[model samples]
Target: MDPLSEVLSLLKLRSYVSGGFDAAGDWAIRFGPHEGIKFHAVVAGSCWLSVEGELPVQVNAGECFLLSRGLPFSIASDLSLDPIHVSQVLPPNPSGRILSYNGGGDYLSIGGHFTLAEGQADLLLQVLPPLLHVRDQLGSATLRWCVERMRQELAEGQPGDFIVAQQLATIVLVQALRFYLSGRKAENPGWLFALADKRLCAAMAAMHATPGERWTLQTLARVAGMSRTAFAVTFKGTVGLSPIAYLTHWRMMQAADHLVSSRCSLAEIGSAVGYDSEKSFGAAFKRVMRCSPREYGRRQGGKGGPMLRSGPTSSSTHTGG
Candidate 1:
């Protein structure tokens, strides 16, 4: 079974939203999740998205804030804003279609809400200021072109419009991730994918391929073709975690899944993950996931029925791109 199959980055989406203002002014949005990432893009209008405890971020039309690590933040017409709903205020002098959010049915099918009732445990919350907008920015040639095309497909409401809209939204989201990641300073990066370095994606590929191998910073630096110091700095800047820290986290996440899903014993699991002893394995697992191997196993077993791991269970599968 592919261990990486069930792993999805915290959050990712592309959306075409209506500019949240009536007047020729800007608006903003703030977002905070107890956990997970928040991402946003502006099709039209202008505003700033400020992370409360972090540095302030500014976004314009055709731009996005890929808050890779979820933080409590807000957006406003100017800085110092709170998340106000699109319906919060109407356009000051309405001559055009001034709606709080983008209009029409296709928006829902495209930007999501397509499977809200499908028991999707990973659904994003609706109450979010993580995404913001402005008035004049929406008039840009680039944004206008994208919005018009999306609107047309959604407006047509044809048989294949649903699929077409989702694909377009996904494209928009990818554009936002690129813009957000490109302009960040060293103080920030992803919270988990620390090995998600511009240069270190290759290093991660190495580790993922051989998680059972003994890894050292020096060796990793060689794989990255940099001095240890330069590799460390670049790796942390892009991934937001140290190399050793990232490896430990990835191992623990995988170990948790394996212990619960596979027939492997604690000793086997520990050895498979580069741990030489059960004690060392248990210690690492606790440090990362806050639970011991025995505790994790006990929790997975039913109170009274044939235990699942007593024999093999049906295998699960997923598709990857």
Candidate 2:
């Protein structure tokens, strides 16, 4: 699998709620702080979206935005209007329905909230900005189609509509990330942004494809068709980590995934990720994950059995509406 696909798979997206709302003139809704990622597409008309800690954004027809940080936000036809909490307008349970407000019909939008596995979301979220706004001019055709399809699926409520909406929401999430990568420059120092550089992509792909391979700067540079010095400079500049550091981080991430998903012994997992000794693996895992492998597995309630009382784990939970 490619690096993006591999990382997403390891993150393990759990559930999603797909729904929308229609509103008329002079209205606003304040959505409280949420968990996971939230995405919205303006289907018709427009509104002002104000996410805490960020400037208010004007979302016009056919435009989409993603909230990666799960912050409090509000949407309004007019920002000055006194906004009501979302619970007052939408149902408590996400039923994939298009709700109406103030008699409806002036503005329309559809959205989806993705709830990823606790403790794994930061793998993706850390590389993303808090708010990603995809304009109509920023190659949003596929995203537009996905949003429209999701709107229809929610509105029509046909058989299998739930599954269809869920799939489309996933597609929207991926496409949004793709568009963000394509439209921006590689100035940002994150692995997600590094994919925009062809050379960095080659080296990263090699690391992801066979993480167990004992790789060095020279070998990875050769894979990227660059000298070792140039490769190191470029990799650090774009990915914000040295080549070996990134490799170790990726290995630990793979090991973490295995710890929760597989019944492999610690030695086997360590060897699979290029560590010859379980002690070395444990140390590396602790350095990167802030917890030992065994502790992590227990905290995650994986095959490692019941949770033992320990210091706080790095995992997080997102409860989306």
Candidate 3:
């Protein structure tokens, strides 16, 4: 359970400042992400969520949508877009009302931090479609429960407001995952389908849980209950990446993240990823990330090394503390 515990712990540390906005006041509310996933809920009435580089995704009262991956996005109201720093529309459409705010109840939003965790949690989270919107008709019951839970947290906001919000976010996430898992059939290709097979899911969990394990084609093959040759071909075809590549990529990604967020030394990082020597680890890191561990750490600190000078001082995927 330690694996599941790690995933839950990171999520527990996350919260999307729980609050509501009312349209009766004709007020304009805005915020900037300066580092995690944000979950916005439309509690009552409708408001416009205008994200740059994409059209405004409308939300009726009671609907919930995550800003996908928390990229630099914006939400605004009608008759007033000011005080809100909106990204300028390229090619200047200045013509369409991206989103329409209607009369009704209050507008509610929940913002929370999100990150990659270990094993099942990490792999499951990776399959999510960017910018998930749960319609009332398609995902109503579970969505309603999530909305009510968040609403309660926002209203009571007691001694455990943070903890309660974290729980609600998880519920919402699980609900979304449930919907995503059942929504499509064999007709549509999806990342989550990889988890549909019990064998694949179990094998994946083992590889992720112990990247440093002396895992090989045969080991993973046995886990999947398939012959080495068959598993190798199927794994690649279904996952779009060879099993070895997938393991290496996930290990390096974890190593890179640790380099940025943890004080673990290079030797520790190498050991964590199954490398016996710092040279081997550094070589793998460079081969994959195009930079050494130190330089990668610098980029993760929010200052770019060479290519990405203008964005993310902390190499973070989300904004804010």
Candidate 4:
């Protein structure tokens, strides 16, 4: 798998809550600080989305936005209006339904949140902006189709609708990320943006494809078709980390995943990630993750299961409607 796919696969999404609300006349709803990424697409009409500590953004029909940091936010027909808490408008326990306010009609939106496995959210969050907004021109028709289908699944309440809606919501999140990557100019120094540079991406892909390979600056530079000095300077400038630093980080991440989800022995896990000894692996894990492998696994309950599961509220964001 590619680097992006590898990272996402390791995240282990647990649950998500998919739903939306409709309102007519002047109205605003305040959602409290959230734990995971929240996404919403304007199915009809428009509103102002005000995230705490940021300027209010106007979202029009056929547009969508993602809230990455789990900040408190408000959606309103007019920002001047007093916002009602979302709990007041939505049932105490949301059931993935289309909620209505003031009899419904004028404004409509559909979306949800994705919750990742314990202690794994930062892998994606560290590389994301606070908010991502995707306009119609930048978004694909497939995203629009997913939004419409999600709306139908939530509103109609057909058998198996929940499963279908959840899958579609996941698709929306992926597509939004794709558009963001495609439209980005690589002006920023981040692993996500580094993919925009073909040379950097080729080197990154090699590391991701074989974290167990003992990679050196020269080997990676050769993979990128550049001299060692040039590759080191460029990689640090663009990816914000030396090539070996990134390799070690990626190896620890892979080790952590295995530690949490497998019954592998410490030596086995260490050897798989290119560490010949448990001592080296433990030191590296502590350095990158701020904890030892055993401790991290204990914190996560050390259960083995499939990487991705269906559920509610987590982290990440997207842009578009």
Estimate every model's Cα lDDT from 0 to 1. Answer: 0.50, 0.81, 0.59, 0.80
Tens-place lDDT digits, model 3, residues 127-224: 55446666667547767777677667666646776566667777776665556556654233333555666666666677768777777889899988
Query: Candidate 1 on 177-221: residue-level lDDT in tens?
Result: 333333343342453233225458667766666666788888888
**By TM-score: ranked, best first:** 2, 4, 3, 1
lDDT of 4 by residue, 219-310 (tens): 99999999999999999998788988888888888888887777677767777787766677778889999998777777666354423222
lDDT of 1: 0.50
In angstroms, the error of model 1 at 268 is 4.9
- Winner on TM-score between 1 and 4 is 4
Which parts of model 4 have CA positions greater than 4 angstroms off?
Answer: 185-188, 302-321
RMSD of 4: 7.9
TM-scores of all models?
0.55, 0.91, 0.66, 0.89
Better of 1 and 3 by TM-score: 3
Quote the positional error of residue 105 for candidate 1 in Å.
16
- Model 1 error, position 37 (Å): 4.2
RMSD over all Cα atoms, model 3: 10.1
Residue 303, model 4, lDDT: 59
